[model samples]
Target: MSRDDRQARRGYHHGNLKQALVDATLELVVERGPQGFTMAEAARKAGVSAGAPYRHFKGREEIIEEAARQGFEMFADLMEHAYASAPPSALARFEATGRAYLAFARKFPGHYITMFESGLPIAQNSDLKRTTDRAFAVLTRAAEELIARMPKDKRPPASMVSNHIWAMSHGVVELFSRGQPGTKTPFAPEDLLESGIGIYLRGLGLIERDD
Candidate 1:
């Protein structure tokens, strides 16, 4: 077989080549930052010829987008379950959704990295955008419920409230969950997130501060 024929053979090497490419992309995103690796390297990692990846993905961007898309889907599911399964209180369910974010990131570092750090513009991919919106909507819904208890004059915009918590959770994940994890600290990431949210809510008078 000519070299091109061998490359073609690699394209047909598996029944699930697309998933293999996605898996390889995830691995590479963690090992080397998303921009650090090339599609050829991903194909090599997946044990396929350089040309084989094109059969499954247009380029590295598509592979990362797929990883991010899957990540958002899983994230939305976890957040939905958390929001649904918590104690029967808006605060409880809202807090549960916050916890779920941490759990998902800790459990799926590769997906986490790909989804948030890959720098791929998810909004361009309709499916990826929808999944991401789903994940975010969980937080937005929780924020809406939590803020509804306050007077309309005092209530923060739901999007701002949700984005605030989202930023806080992301900060905790990056600093404690992913970055500077080995550094000595008195608090775990969960504690930090919980306390951070508590403080923010208290400042907004959304929650009564303990005397």
Candidate 2:
């Protein structure tokens, strides 16, 4: 068969081709935009036969979706660690976890970008969505505790408060990761998240006097 014909077929050459293809595609996605990437190119990058990706990914969309899935899993693991190491208070855990979230984004810029691809069919991938939601739930739970302690008159719902804080951290991290160095905006990523969250806590009227 011609190289083009061989490339168009759906089947990989050997064991581990799936992982190899995924790895190659991730590098490609970082190098190239996610939309234009081709599975055949991933196979070539992996040093596998042109058709190798088919053994694992049904199509380019599947490859992209799975790559995104991997990103969410990495994020969830980091949040799990942050939640465990945080001090015994909702505010403490929220701050620490926000730091962890920023650290993860800074350290894994490629993976972090992939996780929030609204274009990808995340709803179809329930398991991956569930894992991502679990991480978000950690943040929401902390917000809920703070909200509950409020005198009801001044309290916002946990989900609303969590969304505000999450948007703050996520926007800052994303802008910083895009190489916006020290823009000195009112809310610098680090200061804004840690301190901004503290401000939110105070407004919520939930003070945990710690040593």
Candidate 3:
């Protein structure tokens, strides 16, 4: 066996080696993009021998994939909590979820980037797929609730509305929240998202009634 493999086999007995590798991988992901580094580099950064990471991850891709998976899990939890704690109004709950989405991106920039921009093969990772789907389901559920309250003839399809809201929220985060160059908005990202959603609802003829 290669010397690196021997070192990795030794590392398997270290109680915290797996977590150490994961932490090191996260640091690397932030400094370099997810695809920027290798498993050996992560092991070295973690203060372990080059082969140490092999005990925890099959390869560098698995390391990045796990990071992305954890990120999605956190994202889904944040959305769920936002929805659950929101005011009784459907609109309020929906708006709260949007705000939570933006807050998550801001609070955990590294996780957010990996979760959305890592370019990991989510289709091949059931855990990642499930976590991502859970996060998205929050938005879709909120949309369904809102549409259910409208007159059937006046309601837009829940799936389409959900997609529109998700697109708008993501756009606001990328363009305004992240401070990307070009068209600067006077409004804060949160306000912009709120106002944009309001306008969209109004355009759909879904007027908000004072509760």
Candidate 4:
């Protein structure tokens, strides 16, 4: 091989190896479910020798786990920004965080699937668990702020409120936002989520009729 071609090839192998593998894994994940593809395929897609990936990742599972870890960090940042960008009203901030959840799922479908559907438990990795908790905490923080508006005697546990709303938001994303073609819902996911939160708040007597 010519010296210039060899130089270029060397750069390809060494340049940002981990990120290239991660990006390749994400593409494969979108094209095929997490378990559907092999490590060799990931190397091929990343344009490296089949053995190149082992320098950065032990196996496909590690690649997917890394993707999930990054996804949660990005998810937490988006939710934090959404919570801050809204008006100070507790309801508005709470709703903003919920919308952010849907937005992340739609924009990062591969990450979403790997993070939630790949059957990798976040608790297995301390860093992954911390990242996941940060993302979930944004929702719980919003819930606590919103629920605080209620009379203390009538307030529900913030964890309960957050978990319920998280479950509702997750359902909307999976059924509607995740590009599921056959599943039909008459209402847009945003409408469904906002109105559902409203109803839940009203049911708890946390939402006053006047405003």
Best by lDDT: 1
Predictions in order: lDDT = 0.87, 0.73, 0.82, 0.86
What's the ranking of the predictions by TM-score, best on top? 1, 4, 3, 2
Candidate 1 per-residue lDDT over residues 1-211, each given as its tens digit: 6765565466557767788889988888888888999988887777677888888688888898888988999999999999989999989988898999999999998999999987877777899889989999999999999999899988889999889988999988888887566585768999999999999999998788999
Number of the top TM-score candidate: 1
Q: Can you give the lDDT of residue 12 in candidate 1? A: 56
Off by over 4 Å in 2: 1-15, 180-188, 202-211
- Candidate 1 lDDT score at position 118: 77
TM-scores of the candidates are 0.91, 0.80, 0.83, 0.90
* lDDT at position 153, candidate 4: 87
Give per-residue CA lDDT, model 4, range 1-211, as digits (tens).
7544454366386578688778888888988889999988887777776777898889999999999999999999999999989999989999999999899988998898889889997887998999999988988999999888788888888989999999999998877775654368767899999999989888987776545
Clashing pairs in 3: none
TM-score comparison, 2 vs 3, better candidate: 3
lDDT tens per residue, model 2, 83-141: 88888887677777788888887777656656764377666789777877988887777
What TM-score would you give candidate 1 relative to the actual structure?
0.91
Where model 1 places Cα greater than 4 Å from the true spot, the runs are: 1-14, 179-184
